[model samples]
Target: MSPRSASVNEELRRRSRERLLQATVELVGERGYEATTLADIADRAGAARGLVSYYFPGKRPLVQSAVHRLMHMTLSEALEREPVTTDGRERMARAIDAVLGLTRSHTTLMRMHMAGILQAEGFIQCPEQQRLAFLLEDTVTRYGSEQPEHDYRLLRALLMGAVVALLLPGAPMPLGSLRAELFQRYGLEWELGTPPQDEEPAPR
Candidate 1:
């Protein structure tokens, strides 16, 4: 083949691969990782099945890529909503508010992440998941002046669990009130007066 033709083909393939990744993230975020298939991603991305296979090798890689994209997007956006502070207590408070706001805004995406982790042990064991967990741990570790690592981990776990439970179906309480209580329990009483924002997280 001619060099010009080869270069054009390569560019097209690169664009197609990126589109597939984007489509996978959007579909997984909306439907779910398990529910979405290669066909669906191909259609959404305007790519061919053969091309997806060429780019991703298999479904696992595609899912992993999608998860990585989703996590990075969520974390980047979440980190931006509040100012960075050095004081551990203040930072922890801001982080709490940021994370809670992120969860509330992107319940569907958060649910997809939770569901993915629960259903697939291998998937959850991926390095991206480990990295994400470490990021959470690091954020919480900053608040460990008087508390032990175990205590901080426990508090973080409890806080995350409460948020999930409150968000799950058949919970008979108001989400707003429940989230407020959570923030207060975490010593973030300052966020109580802030109005709710309507920004949703990007799809998985």
Candidate 2:
């Protein structure tokens, strides 16, 4: 093949791989990773299974690549966007709003993330899991003191807990209110707009 033709072929291959990866992300959200076979991904991408096998070789690697794509695409990068500052208070409010917005937007992917965690031991080990845990940790750690590592950890745990609560069969908890309460309990009071006004009674 001529050099120009080879370059065009390479570009097409790159696009094909990207489409396959995207297809995997969407399909995994619709049907959890376990239910999503290589054939399914191939069909969704409109490519043959041989092409998927050529690109990814196996199911686990494809899923791992998809997970990495998701981590970098949605969760990890959400915190790094340009800040709309109106002092620290507004920054904090914007941050919280951004976080909640990301959570809502990627609910399905988040569920697949949780499901992957639950079944992680089957085909995944500590290294991959720890990387993700630390990504979440880093995002939380951006908000406060160096000593607040534990607080960041707890906040992520609480966020995941809230997601699970909403996923349960029963009526969803007042998540917005519950999240606000959790934020207050963890020193997010001033960051999320002003606190409500109140008065105390005097003793007789």
Candidate 3:
């Protein structure tokens, strides 16, 4: 049999990496960060342990990238869902809600990822994160921003702060309050961006 072409090999590698990333997300979310290991991720992905090292320097980096991949996928699906609209306000609201939803659903995994980010490396500039950033930037631009660059930074900061607030230990803030503040910041209505059933979304 002929050897696989470079394109085929690259595609295989891409799929392999994606599987590992996905498995990491699942296991970490289910088992929390410290309980999940590279071995577990490799087994879940059905890939060899060596591949984990090849794809990531350590568990922290892999978790960060995996979470970013999840974020990108989550945001992308929300933006491209049925009844698509070109309205920037709607898109921005949807973006906020999508991220907020992820934080709520994957609180354990997201909290660990946040802890890792607060560690030495800060945030990894991985491809997944870049994709997430691109989508958010596009959302901000669509939201009638006269300064998309500035607006994107502000939106990202606000979203991060809200996520942190939601996941804070002991004194976690209400998701509705955080959501409301975000909606108000973008002048989004309570009904926008997968809004919850709460009457007040604003932070008290």
The CA lDDT of each predicted structure is: 0.61, 0.60, 0.89
Q: Is candidate 1 or candidate 2 better by lDDT?
A: 1
- For 54-157, candidate 2 gives per-residue lDDT tens digits of 97757766766665555545544444455433343333444344444434565665556555555743334333345555655555555553655685567656
- In angstroms, the error of model 3 at 107 is 0.9
Clashes of each: 1, 0, 3
Candidates sorted on TM-score, descending: 3, 1, 2
Model 3 TM: 0.94
- Candidate 2: where are CA atoms >4 Å away? 1-19, 31-35, 46-68, 82-103, 120-135, 148-152, 190-204
Distance from true position, residue 56, model 3, in Å? 0.7
- Give the deviation of candidate 3 from the true structure as CA RMSD: 2.0
Which RMSD values do the candidates have, in order?
7.3, 7.2, 2.0
For 30-64, candidate 3 gives per-residue lDDT tens digits of 99988998999999999999999998999998999
Candidate achieving higher lDDT, 2 or 3 = 3
Off by over 4 Å in 1: 1-21, 32-35, 42-72, 80-82, 120-123, 145-152, 192-204
lDDT tens string, model 1, 31-64?
Answer: 8667889999999998877888877766766776
